[model samples]
Target: MTSRQPNHKIPETNIKKRIAVITLKSPAHLYHCVPIACELAKNQKFKVDIYTDTEQTAALIKALTEDYNVSCRIQILHPALGNRLLNTLTRHPARAKHIISHNQDKFRHYDCIISPDFYTAPLITTSEKNRPVHVFTFHGAGDRAYGFKQQLCLYDLILVSGPMIKQRLGEEGILDCTHSVETGYPKFDLLHHTAPKKLFSNHRKTVIYAPHFQRKETSWYDWGLEVLEYFYSSRKFNLIFAPHVLLMTKWRRRKSIPKRYYTSPHLHLDFGSSNSIDMTYTQQADIYLGDVSSQVYEFLYHPRPCIFLNTKKVNWRHNPDFTHWQ
Candidate 1:
């Protein structure tokens, strides 16, 4: 493959280049590259503006801006609709069209737009008069069963994580690597930080069960409850249930999983623990048990020990590298 730097270039700019960081969801997607963005801005040679959906993320970016003294402007992507309103619009096209027309122009006025949702939103900005660059970062689970390749072809630049992903995309005949880059994850830079305090300060043994969302025969609703039951009753360790964040929201309007499982007192369910940027739990947890999730790579930064659920053993043996755990 071409050099990683060429793909995700750190182009030298004598003057600060105005950058717009667009966060459609949680800033967790920014975890992979935000630090680099922050550093580039700190040089007094780059200005970074962040557009996020929530005040929580805006506040976080504001604090980072103050700490770094960079021009970190925060703005909301207007014309956003609540679940109730969106549901109503689905039934009424006239109302949806009005809402769409109102927010059409809010997408312009940016030099480069970096989005984590990995969809067509970034490309939408390219139609503006200035014609800014759009970058899409893949944050979803990649599988052969799913038609992910077709979905990925829509972006200008598709930034992937590891060498395995690079190889897989190439084998799939995805010639889009002309804009693809394997930037060694910026989030893993945390492992390089000199934090005095340990990531986890507890006497109790910890086990993190981070399961991926399964489609048919295998599901968190199916076999995962049993695993949770075992962890809840066991006195040997403290348990963390960090399921794929989308599983709770994507399938249904399930807000938060109730803490009723804490009947044993050793389990902590972090359904409310949300962060756009840093997920430090993967660094702190003692043992990680998960299915097919990318958190395994983050967990590997510390490399304590891990277990794969393997509830569905369809054909991972044919392609070992597909699974991060292998």
Candidate 2:
């Protein structure tokens, strides 16, 4: 068999007999699918592989490997790239054969390819030989804003967490495929497994502020500072700030984010980095605060008092399908 090339091209073949998953390194997103992937692997139902190109993926793989030995390959597709050109050149159709040559045996084994998000299209396209069932887990809740339609258009099955997503996608006229299914987010299975743990001492309260990073309409960029101040001085409570991990890496380069000081002995801030705490922090927090982040669902698994930040003028409170509290 010939080796894979970055731009290798081949006539599409039928290879969707077994399956594996392509994972985005984001913990929030991966949390929904990893357990399911593990279950699939454990049952020997699918030959699974989780692919990522970020340091966070490495950290997550390390953490998960210790807890679950799910007989599957965890492949690092490539290092972070400044642009898609290099990634395209190295892993796209031209180089696909070269890329899969080492894993040709493994690639040929799976029938379906799954991804936690739409960004993994190139990896799935390259790995599957254009034959496997390409399923994507889309976490976005609304209409196509950032090339979402294009990204989602590629999937054979679009796995979503809620009905709102399915309805929204339909509104956008994305009903061509009969594969959209609501699996209720496999990551929430993790939330279901979490027992109530003490996030702070009995003398201190705990608040969790999880913010989304959508800057075009509403983001926590400016008001985040105000939130830091409000929580820092509240000595009675310990604060946990877990912003959407995407915020940290969105800019072209890593910009120096100003440090906000909290004199209160009870404040803690986390930006979803390798060193950040897991969703268990959500279980321990007494109150939850945020804009529009799915982490809210993670927090509401146990039904805590949640205060939505209306900073961006999102009227989410009255939304009929806000099922987190229900």
* Tens digits of per-residue lDDT for model 2, 1-326: 12122222223445323566655445555655667677776754345666554556655865665467656667665433433466576643213323333344454445666766654444433443555566677653433244246446656677777777777667655654335788776665554444545544557778887776778434476577778777776656778777777665544312443444433457765666533435677777889987666667667667878886666565555553343323
Number of the top TM-score candidate: 1
Q: What is the lDDT for 31 in model 1?
A: 51
Clashing pairs in 1: 16-45, 27-276, 28-276
Q: lDDT values of the candidates?
A: 0.58, 0.58
- Expressed as tens digits, the lDDT of each residue in 1-326 for candidate 1 is 22111123445768666776666455555554455556667767667776665566677666655655556667855344564376466742123233333454654655566766544342353453465566665654344334245445545566776676776777765535335777766666545542323323457888887776555423476577788878777767878777766555443424334456854566766543542125556766789887777777777776788887666664666664446545
Q: Looking at candidate 1, what is the lDDT of residue 120?
A: 37
The alpha-carbon lDDT assigned to residue 221 of candidate 1 equals 64
Model 1: ten consecutive residues of lowest lDDT: 1-10
Candidate 2 lDDT (Cα, 0 to 1): 0.58
